[model samples]
Target: MKEFASIDIGTSYTRVLMGRMGDDGVIQINGAGVSPSQGVRNGGVVNIEQTVQSIQTAAREAELMSGLVVEEAVVNITGKHLKGENSRGVVAVTNRDRVVTESDVLRVIEGAQNIRIPADQEILHVLSREFVVDDQSGIRDPIGMTGVRLESEVHIVTAGKTALTNLRKAVNAAGIRVTNLVMSSLASSEAVLTSGEKDLGVAVVDIGSGVTDIIVYVDGGVFSSATLPWGGSHVTQDLSFGLKIPMEAAELVKRNSGCVQIAAVDPIEKIELPAMSGRPPRWVLRQEIAAIMEPRMREIFELVDQELMRSGKKNALSGGVVITGGGSRVEGAASLAEEVFSMAVRKGNPLPLGGFFDRVDGPEFATSVGLLIGAAQSTDTARKAPRESGSGWMQKLRSWVSENL
Candidate 1:
């Protein structure tokens, strides 16, 4: 059995999960924790001390629950600083008789890594989208195939170096070694999307507290990824301004009475506004809240639509859109998205993982749970690497990179 842990640092909260994958292939969750985040803004670390405290608090709770210490973990990263682009690599088969081996595959992927990037950016993930062996295109795997020419198409995700350095500093201060850093949208996809959806072409939009994350998959591989600077907090700000309430009150109202579609709200439904500053409580029609919320939510969806069209994969989404994360929890969000995208839309809840699954089943916990999934996958890769090639760390990385292929 291999034990694994994951930490998801978000603008609103910090979450940790501990679990293990048994030798028999069963994945069991053992512990989990969540705490209000501090020193983080829009997924960037602003204060190392406060970020360390947040991570430690959450990690301690998880360790207590599982009766185990978390010394290392897979961590999630997000923000507008993340960039995803597609690149192609081509190489000739070197062996006699033209049989493409794992070495050829590795060489092609390394060639794909030659992309030019900004001085302050570093590659985070290189996911193979497809392989072509000679004349055969769209081949998922080309290893052991007979081909003189091998081509690889991959999606590369990069993050700002400064952001990553600060993030690692916070995690290290918390006494946890960061094993891997997975993008928030990619992790959320592992938690919410199914094989069918990814194979048929789909977009996973994770609307987080401070920023929205997007990743589109076509033919079971990443096609495009983007991060929008605005997110659910902007909606709360709009409600605060529109309803003449404090931010705390606006957040409360947005959670309880929020609906993004005016048509979905009941005409007579009303909710109580908590009394504040010695003012008596007041009643606001739920539809009135929706009225204040609709325009802002519509604007968010429109922006996402523009991004999809910008990716040029808007029409290729046969599986349409799946919205996850806390921002998508508002009532009528799906209806509003359906209207804007002119296609099917659905809420993405985290898929069940058995133990503690009930505790983290909501869209808000998708990234945390997905981090655990990534942890198991990485462990699996490491365990199989030596058997595959009798090599060390480089082979493990190659296996990790090839997982998407």
Candidate 2:
């Protein structure tokens, strides 16, 4: 068995999960913890001391529960500073029989990486979208194929250098070495999406407290990804302003009674509003609260739709959209998303796990669980003989860049 740990540092909360993959191929979760986040905003660390404290609080809780000490963890990263673009490269086959070999695939991906990158940013992920052998496109595995040329299309994700430096510093200060920094949306997808959805083309939207992340997949690979600067926190702020209530009270009410579609709420059901500084408590219909949440949620979905259209994958999403993260728990979120995107929508939760993980089967735990799964898979891959090229080579290239660049 190989033990692994994952941390999801969000704007509103920090989550830690510890698990192990047994020889039976089952991932058993042993410990978990969640702590209110401080000194973090929009998924970026603003105050190192407070962020460190939050990480320590969450990690310590998980360690105590699992009875294991955590020395390293796979951490998640998200922010407005993330950017992605698509590029393609082609190379001549060099094998004696003119067959596309692993070396040719690696050279092609290296050629694709020759694009110009910004001075203040570093590449975080180089994802293989598709492979083409000669004039045959959409070829997933091109090795051993009789072709004179090999081609690849890849999507590159980049992050600002300062943002990465600050995140690493915060994690190190929390007394844990950062094993890997996975994109928040990518992690969530691993927990929620199935192979069928990816092959048919799907979009995964993770709406956290301060940022909304998007990942689009087509033909079982990543096509595009992006992050918006607004999320559930903005909804709470809107309610606080519109309802004349404190922010804390607004957040509580939103969690308890909020719905994005007024139609889903009963007409006569009412909720009590907490008393403000100078006013007595009042009872308001649930529909009234939905009125405040509907517009904002609709706007968020519209922005996500716009992003999908911008990626040129809007019409190609036959599998539709899957929404996860804490914000997805809000009542009527799926209905609102379906209305805004004019397509099918569903709420996403982490895939089932064994051991002491019943408390973490919700959408809010998707990123952390996915990070754990990713870490275990990466470790398994590292233990095996390295692949000569293709997606495996792309993964190896990313690992190298993540550690060196």
Candidate 3:
């Protein structure tokens, strides 16, 4: 039994999950933890001490439940500083028989990664989208094909060096090594998206407390990704100011009775507003709360739509959109997303894994669960082919070694 761990440090909460592969090769959850996040804002660390405390609390709880000391974990990262773009590279085959080999594939991907990046930024992922051999396009695996030239199209994700450093520091301070830093949206997609969805073209929108992460998939690969600065917390802020309540009360009210679509709420139903320092408890129409939430949620979906349109892949989304993360738990979110994107929308939850996994089966656990799955898959891949280099953090390390040492 091989154990794996994952940590998702969000603006509002920090989650940890520990799992192990069973004889059947299915990952079974052994333990899980969720703690309120502190010293973090909009997915960026604001106070290192507070963030460290939160991470330790979450990780400790998970370790106790799993009865396994966690030394390293695959962590999730998201912030406004993240950027992504598509790039292409072409290389002539250097084989005697003109057949493309594994080495050629690596060289082509390396060539595609040769792009100008800011001095303060580093690449996070170079995801291969398609491989074109000679004039034939859409070849996922070009190895063994005879071609004079090989062209690769890849999506590159980058993060600010400062942001990456801060995230690593916070995780390390919690007494856990950071094995890899995965994009939150990408991780969420792993837990919630189906192969058919990825193949047919779909967009994954993970709405967290401080930021909304978006990833677009086309032809079974990431086509574009972006992070919006606003998220569910913004909606709560709107309700707090609009209803003259404390932030805590606003959050409670939103969770208990908030609906983004006014039409979905019963006109006669009223919610009791919590009494404030100088104000008495009052009854407010549910529709009023919906009014406050509708605009903000719509704005988020609208921004996601704008990003997709900008990517020139908006019309290519045939599988619609899947919404996950804590914010997606809000009532009417899918309907609101559908209205804004003019496409089908559905709430995403972590794929079912029997056993203790039932404890973390909600939308909020998507990223954490996805991280665990990714770590397990990476470990399996490494065991199968020790010589083949994996992507993401491994690729970054390889580049660093070649450039620095």
lDDT of each: 0.88, 0.90, 0.89
Off by over 4 Å in 2: 275-279, 388-398
Please, what are the lDDT tens digits per residue for candidate 1 over residues 263-330? 88889999998678878888999999999999988998999999899889888899999999999998
Winner by lDDT: 2
Worst 10 residues of 1 by lDDT: 385-394
- Where model 3 places Cα greater than 4 Å from the true spot, the runs are 387-405
Count clashing residue pairs per candidate.
0, 0, 0
Off by over 4 Å in 1: 385-405
Q: Of the candidates numbered 1 and 2, which has the greater lDDT value? A: 2
Candidate 3 has a TM-score of: 0.95
Using Cα atoms with residue i matched to residue i, what is each candidate's TM-score against the true structure? 0.95, 0.96, 0.95
What is the clash count of model 3? Answer: 0
Q: What is the Cα-based lDDT of residue 127 in candidate 3? A: 80
Tens digit of lDDT per residue, candidate 2, span 1-405?
A: 668899999999999999887767878888898999999999899999999999999999999999998789999999999998999998999888998876787788778888889999998887888888878999877777998888999998999999999999999989999989999999999999999999999999999999999999999989999999989999999999998888999999999989999999999999999767777779999999999999999999999999999999889999999999999999899988998999999899988878787969899898999999888777766776787445565567567656655
